[model samples]
Structure formats: C-alpha cells, structure tokens
Target: MGKPDAEGHGPAEGLPGLPPEWGRVVVPDDASALAVEATQIRRELRRAGSLPGGHQALGLPLVVLLVAVLTTLAGLLAVTWPRANRGADRPTPAPWSPPATLVGRALPALDLVDADDAPVPLRGLLPAMIILLDGCPCPDRVGDALAAAPSGVSVVTVTGGRTPSARPTIERQARALADPAGGLRSFLGQPARPGAATALLVDRAGLVTRVLPELGTSDTYRNDLSVLAG
Candidate 1:
C-alpha cells in the first residue's frame, strides 16, 4: 500500500521468504544449478530405497561390524587349517635325566657287608657303580660290565633284598639271594617298584652324582663310566 522507495523497494520486498531482499533479480545460471542439484538428490534418494532420514548414521556402524566379523572368521580358518593338516611330525627326545621321584636329591649314605664281616666306607672311592637286579637265574646282567669296569671304579651289585625262594644251586638260579629287595631300597634310594631296575654311580668324592633307571639312564653315568672303563 506504500509507494516504492528511491531504491525501487517496498516494505515487503526486502522481507525473507517473501521475495529477494530488494526486488526480484533474475539469473538464468542460478536456476540451472538448482535444477541439477535437485536431480542428483532424487537419484540418491531412489538408490537408497527411501529418502535419507533418521538412523542414516546407523548404517556406518553396521558396515563396521560386518568387516570385523569377516576378519575374525579369517583368523579362525588360519588356526584350524594347520591342525587339520598335522601329520606324524611329533618328536622323540633323547635319553636324559629321570623324574625326581626316581632319582632322589643328594645321594644318601648306605651300609652294606661283604661275604665277610667287614665295614667299607662309600665315600672317597675313585668311582662307584651300583647295579640292582632280581637274583633269579640271577641273570646278573651287569656283573661282567662291572668286573671289566675301569681299574679305579668299584662295581657293586645289590639284590632286590629278598631271601632266595629255593636252595643255592647253579641251575636253581633263583635260590642264591636273600634280602635283595632291601639292598635295592638302601643302596639305590629307590622304593623298588616292581619290574623296574635302577642303577646309581657315585663319584670318587662320594657325591651322589648320576642315576640310571632301566629306561632313562643318566647321560653322564653312561658317558663317564664308559669313558673311564672303555
């Protein structure tokens, strides 16, 4: 209702959302840009199956979870493949020390008598080798081994500490021993587990050094005694 100002404007002309701040100014290039932008927005909306709305940011986290799950699957596959392909590749260790229960800590002092009533000191001998055997046919597996041992070494055989079942006869090999079981316990420091044989080698200083069982014989005992005697 008011007349135009000197700058060719009215009160409503400069108001936002009604028209341009001054008056309608036409730019053909601006119209073209708007049309192109509208086309791009419509294409994006159609590709997404809906117009962009709430939860649009939730898609990023879903994509991330899928990638993490794929990575975990790959790691599991790698671990399982080697196990599936395992062949007879296990290793067997060489002869070594026996368990602590078999070979005790320090060698303890032992007392024994010969065919005659004489006391012998176990300490300060050049080298002492003890063999435990069940005297039946008294196969004496280690007798020759001990006799032929080095000059300075002493070879003593301890019976499993049992009185022979029958009377002494070369043929009745089972009859010559008494108290064999006890000797095994006192000398070898072993509780004499049945069907088991244990051997001990004490050095010149009487130090409890090497122990050999029927299975896991001491490397040092075999090597040192063999080297000294052999």
Candidate 2:
C-alpha cells in the first residue's frame, strides 16, 4: 500500500513495487511502446553515466549491418555499370535487303553451247557473271557493257529462246552462248521481257546471290558488277 497520487490512484496500482515519487513514469502496454520506453531509459542512463557511450551501446551488430548494405550496393553498381557503358558504345549491324525472285536459290545445270559450238558446263563456270539477253545477235550496247565488267568475274552472255549464231563482232567482247530450248528463261523462274536483260550474280558455290531484273544501262551494269565483285 503506497500513498495516493495526484490522480487519486495509488503509485503501486499500475506500476507495482515502484515508489510513490516514480508514479509519473508510465507503464507501457504494448511491445512498440515498451521499445520506445527502453530507448528513452538508455538515453537517460547514458547521460547519467550509468551506461556506456552511444557508439559503444550500438556495438558490432550495427557496424556489420551498415557494412553489408554498403557492400551490396557497391556490388550491384559494379555489375550494371559496364553493361550500361557497353550498350552505349556498341554499334548496330546493317540490315540485309530481302532476296528478290531467283536470288538465294541454287543455280541448276543447263545444257549450254559457246560461240565455238562446244559444250559448256554451267557448274564448271562457277562464280561467273551469266547475263541473259532476249535475241541471237548480241546487241552492240550490251556487248560494250559486258566489256566493262569487273575483273575476276567471267561474263557469259546467253541468248534466251534463240539458236546460236555467228556474232563475230561481239565474240571478241564476251563469250556468247545460245539457249535454243528456252531452258535459261525457265531456269530464271520467269520469262524474259522483250529487250530486257537479266544478270545473275553467281558465287563460287554456283549459288545466285542477286538477280538484277531489267538492268537499266551500261553504267548501272558496270556499277552493279563492281559491287558484286567487291
């Protein structure tokens, strides 16, 4: 039994075994409030020299938690920083153009004869420039264009749907061949238009890399052939 407080309640009523003078101290009802009261008591104890300094009170566990957080942040930055820089420095590759009809297909063998009336094997003439023209006598304009063809690419002119004829004038310019049965046109997957020449760029493996349909002019032919050779 203790003395009654100003509120007319005994000091030991709520806080048992505490003096009447300590009645002002509140008794916490929950865990959160208890933690708050404990912290306040520790601060007062430190000021009164009853407890250790604030840094010593927050000992090795607090130091370890701070170090772990800093290390994790540093590790994350080290991993992500190089990726961000590399993405900025990397160059995008050029887009490849879609293949035209007959392009990207393997060139099949065809029965072809040269101006000398000798058999010419299409597969043996790999990586060669096979230009298909519409008529027998190779046109002077087309012959001159074939003459300006880039080096390393053999130019063989095939007359589409026409028999082999003596073209003494153009023979010095290009090796003129004849496709009497229109086999070359069928091999192209389409019919050759009137006076329109189609040039096929064949690789070393006898694969058609490009199909230039209705090639415009001698300059255009020369430029296109140069690029293919390069």
Candidate 3:
C-alpha cells in the first residue's frame, strides 16, 4: 500500500503487471452520472463510425426544401416540354387565300347571255363598265350612265330577278341585258338590297379595276369610265 496523499486517499498501487502507459480508471458512484457518461460515449462512437446501426436524421425543414425543389423541377418540365416538341415536330399551316373579289384579279370562267337569249361576250367586251340594277327598272340611272360613258367605254346594264317582255331599246352603244338566274349577282358576291346598284369597271386586260358597291352618283361612273377608256 502507498502512503495517503493530501486528499486522504491512498495512491493507486494494484495491477503492477499492466503496461506503464495504462492510466488509472475512475468510476462514479451515482447511477444517473454513469448513465450520462455512457450516453456521451455512445454519441462520440457513432460520430466516429465506430458504432453500428447509426444513421443521420434529416430535419423537417431540409426534407420540405428537397420536396419543393423536386416539385418545381417537375412543373417546369411539364410546362415547357410540349411547346418545344410542338415547334420541333409539327409543320406549320399554309396561309389562306383571300375571298374571290374581282378587283385586281381576272374574271372567272363565266357564260353570260342577254335577254334575247344571245350570248354576251364579256371577255370580248373588255374596258367596259357593268351597272347591276337590283329590285327596280332604274331607267334614269341607266340613262345617265349610258350618256356619261366615254367614247370608247361600253355601258352594259344587267337587271336581276325577272325577264320582262318589254325591255328598253339598246341605244348609245350600250346594251341592256338581263340575268334572270341571279348568276351575275352571285358571281360578283353582291348582296341583294332594294334599289341598290353596283358598278364594276373593267380594264382592257380583262382585270376589274374598281368595284363601287353602292352606286350613288353618275360622276362616279364618269370618273371610272374615263379611267377604263384610258
């Protein structure tokens, strides 16, 4: 036995066969203090990878952030994938042609005949002004158009709906014709209205230059007729 130190405890003298590097071990008397020491040792061993069955526990905030990131990525893919694929895979459609209006275009293949059942040669009669009379005889307007026509311009009035037995006499190098089938109105796409007249000015090249929908004045006819004659 060794002599007592100042703390009134004897120095360690047992286990002399142990190596010099082995130090004295201490044990606490209280059970609670022993449990605390055991818990600290286990935690250190787990962190150092010396303990088995140890895994890191992710915090609630970290798990929520990961889930949000994945959801955002999925949403981005859903929104953009179809648009990219459509631009790459689908062929664009061709532009549509405008509706058939005679202005700046050649006349369609038409077979027109006069009231006497004689075939009216419209193609042959180029550089002409055609006045379409709707729902009335419109003799005064027809007369004004015939008189105002320039020397080379031919005035042709086409009346729709009926074939009267007493037709106006074709005078002043103008021809009074009738379209009982409403074929002329359909060809020109003119809407039917009471006392509404439409004027079409055709050039020498068989291309319609101007289309006046509501023919108001004879001066309109005169100006377009002069242009047609020129």
> lDDT by residue for model 2 over 1-230, one digit each (tens)?
32334334533224334345433333222224345545765665566565457566666535544443344344334333433344777788754322475777888888788767677877676666777777223466556655676776677778843455434444455667887777767777666666667777787677787776665556665665676566
User: Which candidate model has the greater lDDT, 1 or 3?
Assistant: 3
1-230: candidate 1 lDDT, tens digit per residue = 22233334442212223223334422221223346545754565466555465247445644544444343344334333444335667788564435555333444545444434233343433366765555222234454444345666666555533333232323222212234226435554435545555566666555545666662334334566764343
CA deviation > 4 Å runs, candidate 2: 1-99, 135-138, 165-172
The candidate scoring highest on lDDT is 3
- At residue 211, give the lDDT of candidate 3: 80
lDDT agreement with native, every candidate: 0.45, 0.60, 0.61
| Model 1 RMSD in angstroms | 22.7
TM-scores of the candidates in the order shown: 0.38, 0.48, 0.50
Runs with alpha carbons beyond 4 Å of true place in candidate 3 = 1-101, 161-173
Model 2 lDDT, full chain set: 0.60
Question: How much does each candidate deviate from the true structure in C-alpha RMSD?
Answer: 22.7, 19.1, 24.7
RMSD of candidate 3 to true structure, Å: 24.7
Give the candidate number with the greatest TM-score.
3
